[model samples]
Target: MSTDKKRFSADGPAPRQRFWKEAGVQETADGFTITLDGKPVRLPGGNPLCVTARPLAEALAAEWAAAGLDDPKGRFTPADLPLTRIAGTKIERVRPEREHIIATLADYGAHDLLCYRAETEGPLTVRQAEEWQPWLDWLNERHGITLRVTHGMMPIKQPEPALQRLRTLLATRNDADLAALGVAVPALGSLVLGLALADGAITPAQAVAAASVDERVQMERWGEDAAILDRIAAMNEDVTDAARFMELGRG
Candidate 1:
């Protein structure tokens, strides 16, 4: 991937100028659409921001409605509306540039978080192996890709064949699903966790928890602090939002 191709944002384009008296959802013959001041909402790409799932449409409408309350200036940021941000990216970025996204995701598998373990012999090592080994085994059985587990942070030379198989599996996802996977992959720092979520093998909450196993184990040993706990809570929300985004896209 080119350096420019690798530098993509999930937020996609900047937030549109808000100029609506009211925001709501409208059901159409095709599906559901969000409306601003009785007019249908349009994505940055100039296409109608419509979805087949009523829940997703409603969620998007609600995001717009909330923006009205929060910003009296009629200005909103992408950070304020997670669902709308994702929907916009699905249309503007992910759909148009999918191959690059696939390559970016496949790169994560080369040095997957699950394939690295602590060198020291202690509870943390045991915890990592116990939580990580099953998914490694699952990959081996399912795709004949056996990732080597290393005891240190040094780079591991993963087999090119295994990496190719992982990339092949990633290519099977549609744009919306791929967008969600892209978010989950970097957030969790585990390509396997991202794949598990995409494959419907694990819930978003499970993915978040699994990715933070080492941190949680350390928290357990040293007692939870307020700052770390708050950070974890925010991360959990982001991961769950990505998972929900994928589910809505499927609908």
Candidate 2:
């Protein structure tokens, strides 16, 4: 599929005025599709914006319907339709490049954030072990994927078998799931946590808390800055949205 749709493009244009009076979902042979006033919605790639799950389709319809409801001029950006963006990624990117995307995400396992710890003994170090180690252990116990943990910024090699196991596990996921991981893994910097979130092993709030251990400790030592807080808030939203996308896509 062509990946040149402009509605979701970051540099394409300003928010457009809402044109559709209503959005709806329809079940089709292809899957569940979102519709605007009974017409199907198309992706930036011009492919039908469809998903396998009715709930996800309905969610996409809701996003589209509510896109510019609060604006006086009824203007909204692609950001307003987060689920559509993810579903688009699944169709435009993951479906065409599943193995490549799987490999890319699996590589995050090789250097998962949970494997890196604070270099010295202190609150940061204590917090790292307290907040992160259990998840690493979960990777080992739950998935039989044992990763090597280390201190300091110097890179440490993880076991080849472990990395291969991650790849194998990721290979089993559908395109929709891979799309969600594409968002969650990078946002949390840990395939372990991403997998946990996707598998319902942890909540988005817990995932964010686990991922933000170092940042939280740092902010505690050195006063919290508005920018850092904003970044954390955005990460929470992204991770939460990704988790929600996965959950809704499953149904």
Candidate 3:
């Protein structure tokens, strides 16, 4: 396939490419590889677009096949092929910028979700402490990283040793998991949730619920309007997608 015809690009949006008529997977020496129109798909850089996991390769091939066969008005968007998009990011972006991705995600630890609390003593504060403190305690017990919690929005600086410990843990991951972290950390606004998801300590649903605990409390105190409900739905989808990507990326 021509580079211009590729549906997803690493840097930004691209013009719509012609969708293939068929898709399948090839068992290559490297691993399971996706094939479009009976030929192996190539990345924009001309490298073979390959996946190491069979389930992921099948999912990617299925996405391409669905894209090709389902578009009459050419309505197939990047959102329709999240697996392929994430795979592209893993190969083209994350692999090349592993250290930068690690550093950036690790920096989220300094101001993680657990570090910030509601200002006043209310249901929100109690809920925040109840929902968030366990994860903080977990980190303390498991990793010896004692993060300080503060009431209010002001940034509290975490200890340098804790930050370095997190940076070391993030550095140990391979490209695919790191790429998943790049999405998960920002999506949930919590490095602890991302690490929990990465280490199989929590499910995506639990992560989403924990990440939105404040919002959930607000909804309970007042009432959830359509806008907040819609946002929660979207966030759930994004977090679930990242979680699935992490799972499939695992061999």
Of 1 and 3, the candidate ranking higher by TM-score: 3
Candidate 3 pairs with clashing backbones: none
Cα-lDDT of candidate 1: 0.80
Candidate lDDT scores, in order, read 0.80, 0.89, 0.81
- Which lDDT tens digits does candidate 2 get at residues 132-226? 98998888898998999899989999889889999999999999889998988999999999999988999999999999998888899899988
TM-score: the better of candidates 2 and 3: 2
Cα error, candidate 3, residue 110 (Å): 1.3
Rank by lDDT (best first) = 2, 3, 1
lDDT of 3 by residue, 176-205 (tens): 788777778888899998888888888888
**Which sections of candidate 1 miss by over 4 Å?**
1-19, 26-32, 44-47, 68-76
User: What TM-score does structure 3 among the candidates reach?
Assistant: 0.88
The candidate, 1 or 3, that scores higher on lDDT is: 3
TM for every model, in the order presented, reads 0.83, 0.94, 0.88
Model 3 C-alpha lDDT versus the unseen true structure: 0.81
| Model 1 agreement with the true structure over 75-107: per-residue lDDT tens digits | 556666888777777778888898898889888
